[model samples]
Target: MKKDLWIGGEYRSAASYNELKNPYNLELLAKIGSASQEDVRLAISAAHQAKTMMVEMPAFERAEILEKVARFLRDDLDECARLIAMEAAKPLKAARAEVNRTIMTYTFAAHEARRIHGETVPMDAAPGGQGSLAFTVREPLGVIAAITPFNFPMNLVAHKVGPAIAAGNSVVLKPASQTPLSAYRIAEYFHTAGLPAGALNIVTGSGSKIGEVLKKDDRIKMITFTGSPEVGRYIREHSGLKRVTLELGSNSAVVVDEGVQLNKVIPRIVNGAFAYQGQVCISIQRIFVHESIIDEFTEQFVSETRKLKAGNPLEEDTDISAMITRGDVERTKQWVDEAINNGADLRLGGSAEEGIFQPTVLVNVPLNEKVSCEEVFAPVVHINSFRDFSEAIDLVNDSKYGLQAGIFTNDIHKALQAAKKLEVGGVMINEIPTFRVDQMPYGGVKMSGMGREGIKYAVEEMTELKLISFKTE
Candidate 1:
């Protein structure tokens, strides 16, 4: 299959191309465009033109287009899921789940487009504005540059592109180099669903080159990036004046209070820690268990982790897949080794095979260890015992990345208290830190990210608010 850059509503080959390898089996899937500076400029110009056309499109029409895209996605669901599984190294079940999530995001965005109503501000309530009538409406913010990550490539792309289109904004999407095919396929659906030319463009290339060009472009009004915190900071520093929504890295923690039922919570914690090989931003990197139940929790958690099937992602029965690459596996192993050297105990699954690192569990981890403090985006969980809820909360909040945190407590008051005190963006009670609904406001409080990505919230972020006033006698 031929893969090329999608520009101005058509597929255009780049001056140079790069090979896309399947992270799972190391097979060359296809070669995609290594978009150049000129290509980036063209994509930006196309997006600007598309944005103007999109803004003129009636809200209802945009909603119709999105609804059609959702339907088309359902029609091609199997193909989409297979492609995602092929490139992203996600297990078959997880890849299927991501496809379903992609559909939901588009469906929700379609419905939200019609509900994008502006409110009338009561000018009469103001001290000197009794005679004035004022209200605000949401307007498209021209061109949006959506830079999605490799993990959950299809769904995260939908999270950004769906809302951008639904809000009548044109998008220039730069899918992760490792997994660009799935996103490009989705962009094709936009065209087949009769979305206007230039409304959605895909540029596949080196992030450093294409990303810098897009971020530096003045016409690209907003950037929605999902990647590492290091890259996110660079984007913020270099990109001037334009709006940016960054969903960055996280070292998310889940606190299990003594008030919780151990039997039910331990399994959930295991799933949260080991799922997707723990590549998710909200995956439980650190677990702060109340000292009373620490031993019990650790025992059960290790048992459950052992039961997970680790192998090829394409295999239907495999519970865990390879890390995105061999480098990822090595990095995870290094983190485990460093933690062990720094007084942390490797409780279970610390071995590596080829490109697969075993799902690892570390106990009695030092507070200052990299595994405890850094964003270890791998299938490794660091365990620490806390004597009190306050101490657990403090430990959880100590990280700079406050994306999401979980508390397993039966006490409603304690749940509410943790919800209030936790510095993360979302809090789940009786659940692990990995819980997320597509409709919820999903962004971090601190270094995790800047803006929300749910359908309603993302539409708000993708558009600009404009107030109209009139002088009356």
Candidate 2:
């Protein structure tokens, strides 16, 4: 299959192409166009050109367009799942879930488009203002540069593109080089749904070459990115005052308190820690457990880890698959080795056979180890025992990245306390940090990047608030 650059609502041929292969078996999947400097500039220009049409578009029309796209996604859910599984190496079941979530994301964007409204303000509260009426309205920020990652390609793209359209903004999208197929398919959906020409342009290939143009382009009004912390910082520092919504890295933690239900909790943690090979930004990497229940928790967790099927992502029974790249697999192994050398106990699988790294577990991990401190974006988890409840909270907050954290406890006060003090954007009570719905306000603090990325919140970020005052006094 050949995927050309999506420019101005048409597929254009590129000077060069890059091969996309399956992460598991290296099977040739598709040949993606390698976007050049000219292509990136063209994409930017196209989006800038379409800003007027997008701005003039009515909210109901935008809502209807998104609804149509959602229907298209639902109709092709199985095919989209297969595409995601083949390109991104996600398991079949998980890929289907992502497609379903993407459908909801577009559906939510449609709902939000109709609800976009301004609030009335009272300007007569001051001493000199007696009869002045004021109100504030949200307006689109023009062209948006949306750079997505490989992990959750379709759903994440929908998170950006759907809301950008809802807010009446044009978009120049750069899907992760590893998985551009999903982006191409999505662009086709929008084109079929009757989006204006140049409203959304997708340019594939090298990130550095394209990113240099995206960050420095004045025509691009905003840049919404989800990737590594380093890249997010680079875009922020270089983009000047362009609005940026960056959802970056995290080594998310989960607190397992005493008196927790083991049978129900262990499977959730295992799924959270190992799903999609833990490529998710909020995957549970660090686990702080109460000392009293630590033994039973560890036993069941290890037992469950052993049962997960590791094979091809196309197989419906497979629970784990290969990492996005060999570099990522090697880096994960190195981090695990460093943790073991620093005195962390390797309680379960620690080696990689073939391309898939077995779902691994560690105990007694030092807080300063690489696996503990850094965003291990892998299928690895480190467990620590804490005697005191406050101590567990402290351990969860010790990281520099504060995306999200989870706590499993029956006590209402403890759950609320964890929610308040976890220092993360969201605290999931009796659930894993990986739990996220399509319509919630989601982002992180500290090194986890800035801005929120749910549909309604993102619509707010993609637009500027303008206040109009009527001086009737």
Point to the candidate with the largest lDDT: 2
TM-score, cand. 1 vs. native: 0.98
Best model number under TM-score: 2
lDDT of 2 by residue, 1-473 (tens): 89899999999999999999999999999899999999999998999899999999999999999999999999999999999999999999999999999999999999999999899986767786778888999999999999999999999999999999999999999999988999999999999999998999999989999999998889988999999999999998999989998999999999999998999999999999999999999999999999999989999999999999999999999999999998888998999999899899999878897789989999999999989999989999998999999999999999899999999999999998888888999989988999999999999999998999999999999999999989886
How far off is residue 319 in model 1, in Å?
0.9
Candidate 2, pairs of clashing residues: none
State the weakest 10-residue window (summed lDDT) of model 1.
464-473
lDDT of 1 by residue, 1-473 (tens): 66989999999988988888887789999988888989989988888887778988998999888888888888888778888888988888888888888889999999999988788888878788888878889998989999999989889999999999999999899999999999888888999888888989999888998988988889999989999988999999889999999999999899888867787888888889888889998999999988998898899888888899988888888888888989988888888898898889889988888677889999999978888788989999988899978888899999889999999887788888898999988888788889988999999978998988899999999888999876564
Alpha carbon lDDT of each predicted model:
0.88, 0.94
TM-score per prediction, in order, is 0.98, 0.99
Each prediction's Cα RMSD? 1.1, 0.9
